[model samples]
Target: MPNLELLRIVDSIARDKNISRDQIYTDIEQAVASALRKHFNTEDTTEFTVAIDRQTGDISATRNGQAVPLTLLGRIAAQTAKQVLIQLLRQDERGSIYEEFKDRVGTIVTGTVARFDGPIMFVTVGRAECIMPRSEQIPGEEHQVGQRIQALVREVRDTPGGVRIILSRSHPDMVRRLFEREVPEVGEHTIELKALAREPGHRTKIAVSSIDSKVDAVGACVGVRGSRIKNIVDELGGEKIDIVRWNESSQIFISNALKPAEVAEVSLCFELGRATVVVAEDQLSLAIGKRGQNVRLAAKLTGWDIDILTPAEFKAGVDRLDQTLKSVPGVTQEMCDKIVALGLINVFDIEEVGAEPLVEEVGMDADLARRVVERCTEEAKVVAAEQEAKKAAQALAAAEAASAPPQRDARDEAVLAALGLTPGRDPLEKLAQAAGDDAGAEPAGNDETAKLPDPRQAVPGGAPETTVHKEQPVSSADTELSPEEQAVSLPDSGRKAGAAVEHTEETNADTAALAEGRAEPPASPGR
Candidate 1:
């Protein structure tokens, strides 16, 4: 039998290897219980402990507070079982590395390339071995054995075969971690990274802002002259870095997130998770980037669909679209095209009778269409009226320009003479007669002649001069009155006092002649 000192030495070895003494005792107890069950065909109701004496080289098995009877051969065989005990202790010491790092999934960690199993790169991260699959490694970068690399812990799983840890270097979080390590503010919570978007080994955009007013968020991440970001870039195989300022407003954030491109306008539709960004004509290429990488990353970072357009392209598109719409069925080519370009393409879409669509359609907004329709209709009316006026004016000008210096027609002399006007006399006389004016020729400064209203005033193209009333106040007021009142006022106003006295003999002679012509006044004249 082994001495008690040997047992003590074994316990010391187990303790040194971080194995507990109670664990060792428990193992032996289970072994004893198993052995007794096999040998005796009976389950023991009592528990047992393997004890050693320091003074004597004696081994004792106590059951229910008493020692068990055993031969020297059995005792010697059990005492010689130190190698078996050590084997069991070693099994207990093997802890799973996967279990240690499983909680670290979705975070960044450093690892060494352990080996490659065909396409998969086996990496050792701390206590466990994680795998960086071919899909997760940075393209064109080789992972040599024992090469140190930082990667994102993507997943962890345990199967019957063994524990598996999946890793990635292409993940956006990988870049985030690099920034956290290189920038102290990130780790200290002074600067927070709101989102990350990465094109592994190509370019990465990180949206970061500062919780502290004192800290310059982008400045700290970029370091001085971009030293900090440069370090991270070098680690990522010279991947490009874009540090965008974070904004609370998503529109502003997306605008910043799509950096390296100048944005002219950013329109956000949060309900649809979309943003339409309009850039200058020159900035289109930059906003879309080489093969649209910039906008792609911006989409991932902002979690929104980004539609990019150049101002000129958008406008031209709007124009061409409107032109096409003018050709729609049931629409005049010009009107349809105008309204379509205005963004109303369908009959139901016609917001107004003219160029505006009635409802908000895909291309046209309601209010804009309403205004456009009003403007177009109004403009069309003005244009039509102006066209008529221009034709008339041109005709009139042609007639005036074609006239032969106003030589009077000899045939019209009879009519002018009846109206007390001469053929080659004042043009006003011919015009007044042609316009059906009953009043005689206007005398210079004579209120009666000047007050003569123009008959052309009732018709278009009549004399514009007669259309304007003469300055004689009483003539206009008397003309506005009833014929009865006018008749009453005219006689008194028409005769001058001296004219009446001078014309009395002629007036009586005229009356006597009318009486002689009509009645017995002829007999009185004979007597």
Candidate 2:
């Protein structure tokens, strides 16, 4: 019965591992037979072969056509069978994990958090554990043990430890997969995902187009009442997603990429992949987003160097350049207009070309061209210096902003008031100041915080009330005390009261000795 039970276990392992039951049984037989032959030191003429009965699960081994002794299957044979089975199961499991997950990379998968190895999390997807490294995790998403999660299958690494299933929540493609998951048309290939740019956990811009002319790609991705995309947003912990229809024309595509903002015009230099997009002054804020996020995403999505300029700013730049060129002698309005027409729109451009190129392109007088170039060069230096100053100012402002102390909110101010603390004042500062003024204070050069001997604690009998004022006179009663009694510490009576106490010569001498100590100055050598 026990031996038959082993057969059932082998079948279970085969199903779990997706391994052949016959192969596993054969491996067990050979390992046992090998161990037995080695233990018995079989003769040179003998050769071993092992078999497992298909139906009965009984094992048999022969040496040169003679049956080997059953005693050959001892402790050694059991250990060998265990080693072989473990090795086979591990290898099979690795193969299954690798095969099942390798092709699934770049796709989303659901898993459960199984464990944590420092910053890396082990998420169990089916029978395999996937690795979610800290680098690939969403910024603020905290995972806990046994929590169900969904992440993109980023990579599958076959390692000596095992098959590594690496997953990611922060990959740009993960958002693409999420869209495909929620939008049926995307999954079905009716809607093609043309481009995507993402700052994970912040925002994503995706361009989608439909193969069928009748289908609205953006509308489909958005769904009716945004129901389809809402599922994805919830799954992403509310990360913002922008889906727009893709356009073949670069101008139209760029305008669509910078959404939620109205664009006045888009001029493209396809050679440099540059797009100059003009927006109304009011729409400029929306076009730039917070910290240029909208423009940055637009640039990434369209594969262009996007420059967002308000209409007024563009006009101002053009007018300023025209006026600067006219200010230079030998550079006439006609000359400036010709330069603008040639796309040499700024003084720096003219200065960089020098007089030779200017003569070749504009056919101006050689002497005049040289003067204009020299003047432009001087003006360019001033502009460069101004720009450098502006940049330095901006850098200083940014540094200040980063290092500035946070302004306290109303609640925080109220709490501080209730605690009797002023803004910018440490709560314990007054207490420390008062402590410094006390007799137990640390020594300083001044009387306050100075370490003076306290006679009250050192004396046998209670001391008489006395004043600590330096200007106060000692009384006649002080001079009557013995050298031993001088050590008694007196309580500080008010300076005003001690000022009335009369001092005799002997009393002053005794008070001096008491406060200063009895040690005499080193006896001077006989002079």
Candidate 3:
């Protein structure tokens, strides 16, 4: 009856903990064996086996295959067995938690806030608790104990304490998974989330596409009258979301990326992967957003370096770039016209694509290709010089205008070190420093002659044919022989093309040229 009761307890634990019955039974058996070893002080040498009968629930223990009376294990062994069983069960529970959550990483899970350990918070996720590290938490968002929340499972690991499941609210996938949860079309594979850029707790820019033509990707994600997306926004503590339509054309995609402000035109430098976005003067502030956040997020979303500008500003910048490009010496008027025709109107654009665009794509000559790349390389240095000069002029103006100091970024310090002037120091020093930088940045040789074509195997039109020959030894006797008889003494007979080798004919004297070391005449019997 006691054995049946023990079996019943095992069954109950197996069902409640979602652990296998065999696993529970095995743990119980090991616990009994462990208790026997502890009580008998034979943990190392003596072996003990414990088993439970499947049908009758009869339990038994043996020492070296011999039966041991149950009475031998007193209250002391029973207490030890119970303690061991609890420990083993806890271990099994932890193992179960790890196995359950390991595959669940990069997915959303709900949990009640369990407790806090310093900056880290613990949330009860079903059978186990997950940790939300300080870095993974949403910035400025507070959590209270017993509050239910959904978080993305960022990581799960086995640690000394047990299975540690790391949860995250700031992960980009959290928003993606939330959309998958709320928007049935996303989960149903009708609408696909293409690219996601998030500044968690601030804003998120998601590019989504639709597989079905009838289904509007952005509309479906937004739901009917913004009901579906509103739920996600609320859950994220009112963090703003921009849902952009994914397009095959990057220009269109980038145009879509800078939404809510409306883009007037997008000028793309494909080689450099940069897009100069032009917006109306009125829309400029909206396009740039507060502290350039909108443009910054748009850049992140499109994976392109974005520069926002007004129409006038863009044209002025274009004119400046075109002037800087012409500074490349060896650049002729015709070549410059061809370069503009080929869409390389700026120096950085040419530098980005290298000489390949001019030669291969635009069909420029090989010599011109090398010259163009060199010109662009030099032009880049010139542009940098002009920018530095402009910066110095601005600094001088600022010094003359007011006594207020300017704030600078820490990363700028490393760059400023090379300038020989600190941020707030003298503007006069910067003029010399800028000149020095330009001098050092110049190519080793005169920019025009510095870059030359590599040794070419295939010249334009075609390469000349090359002839191969090996040296042959001649005897002194051959040189002493008559021109006609030189062949017999030559040890080999040879004929030349287009020349008669008439044997009657004074032994075909052309052969003797070898003996005299003179040029061989053209002749052959086959002619």
Candidate 4:
């Protein structure tokens, strides 16, 4: 009866843990040997041996070549054996889990959000539990307890605690695996996913190509009416995905990579592994995307450093390159055009290529190539300084605009008019009018000097008078102020009170001058 019970227990554990029956029998033999050692108080393992019969599940033991009765091992020995058996069974379970999940790495698995330990989430995937670290979770996505979650098995580690399976939802491969699950062509190898770039929750770009010409890789992946891609987008919490066709040519690939923004031209510089993409001015924002996300992902998907430019900027760069090359002593217009045709868009490109490419590719004399490179290097430095200064000026202007007070608009003017106040009339004039009304005096006239005190009048101590200059007739060259002058003249409100008063007087003067045909009103400063 006891032998039958032992066999039944072994069979049950083997089935539950998915372990081999033979392995369980071996564990039972070791457990019996440990019990015998405790019973005899023998430290030497060689003195005792234990075995379980394969056919009958009968456990037999011997001490120093003498048969030992199993019943005589006592209750304490049986309890010790029980503990050892439980421990061995756990190790076998862990080993089984490790072996099973190790091959599953890079594959997607669906699981329940079992529990959370702070930011780390533990998910139960089939018989094993996996960990999803905070870094692997998609940004702005949250899961509740028992929620269904899908993630890629990024890694499986045989840790001391057990099998540690790490899950990731933010990995680029996660998108690839999701496509394989949603798109049948991908699974059957009819369509190949060449590359993928992702910004977790924001967006993803995947490049695909078809092995069979009739397959239509992108169309098949997208499905009818965007049904297939829609399912993927919903699964990714509405992440915008761009599916682009893959091409062997880098220029074509780059142009396709930056889709939704038509590329006017694509210039490739093989020496630098860079692509200069020119788009129409209207498509510039679309190509760059919000905060440059579009071009950034395109660069990753195509394996090239992408520089996006509008048509005007592209023409300016090419023109600058032509001028710089022509300025070199030995470089003719034909040589410059040849260099530009080689994708040297600007002085920076020539500087990066050095003299070797000029000599080998451009077929220029060695000494002349060196001179050309030297000239280009110096020009590149000057261009870099100019670009840096322009960027700085733009940043400063943006800061000032952000800090300046809001200007009064038509709505504000309407509100003032409703309150019985003139919109554009000066505040000081309003005050003077109130004083005149209280004293029973006539309201001030339109005469400019009578309306306000003269700033040019000297104070009692013969101190230098503060003069308010009238707005001069601004010529085309003097229309815009320098950064330093703008900073000094513009107040926190963006328009100085004195400047406003002077501008009113200047407008009257310009009106008078135009009526007498003395001068054309200075062209309103370009917007």
Q: Write the per-residue lDDT of candidate 3 for residues 386-493, one digit (tens) a residue.
A: 989999999999887787656567867666767656666655678778888898894563333424335574477865655433223455556566777665543443
Candidate 3 regions with alpha-carbon error over 4 angstroms: 44-46, 320-345, 396-527
Q: Model 1, stretches more than 4 Å misplaced?
A: 1-25, 28-60, 63-99, 106-108, 158-162, 317-527
Clashes of each: 8, 3, 4, 0
Q: Give, for candidate 1, the lowest lDDT window spanning 10 residues.
A: 343-352
lDDT of 1: 0.69
By the TM-score metric, which is better: model 2 or model 3?
3
lDDT of 2 by residue, 23-77 (tens): 7886677667657665676634248777777777777778778887656567876
**Cα displacement (Å) at residue 237, model 1:** 2.0
lDDT of 4 by residue, 270-374 (tens): 888888999998999999999999999999999999998888888888898888888878788888878877888989899888998888888899999998888
Cα error, residue 251 of model 1, in Å, equals 2.8
lDDT tens digits by residue: candidate 1, 1-527: 65776568657856565556666665555555445443444556455445544444355666677766544225534543544565565555443345466778878888888999998999987656788888898888886898898888998887645577899988777887778789999999899999888888888888888989988999898889988988998888888888889999888898898887878877654434567788987888889988989999999989998988777755654454454344333334554444444433222223234432234333455554555555445544654587799999999999988984666576677777787665677758567676775465554664444354556554576554443333323565545777886775535545565666667778687788787786334367557
The Cα local distance difference test for each model comes to 0.69, 0.79, 0.81, 0.88
Error of 2 at 89 (Å): 1.7
Per-residue error (Å), model 1, residue 377:
26
| lDDT winner, 2 or 3 | 3
Best by lDDT: 4
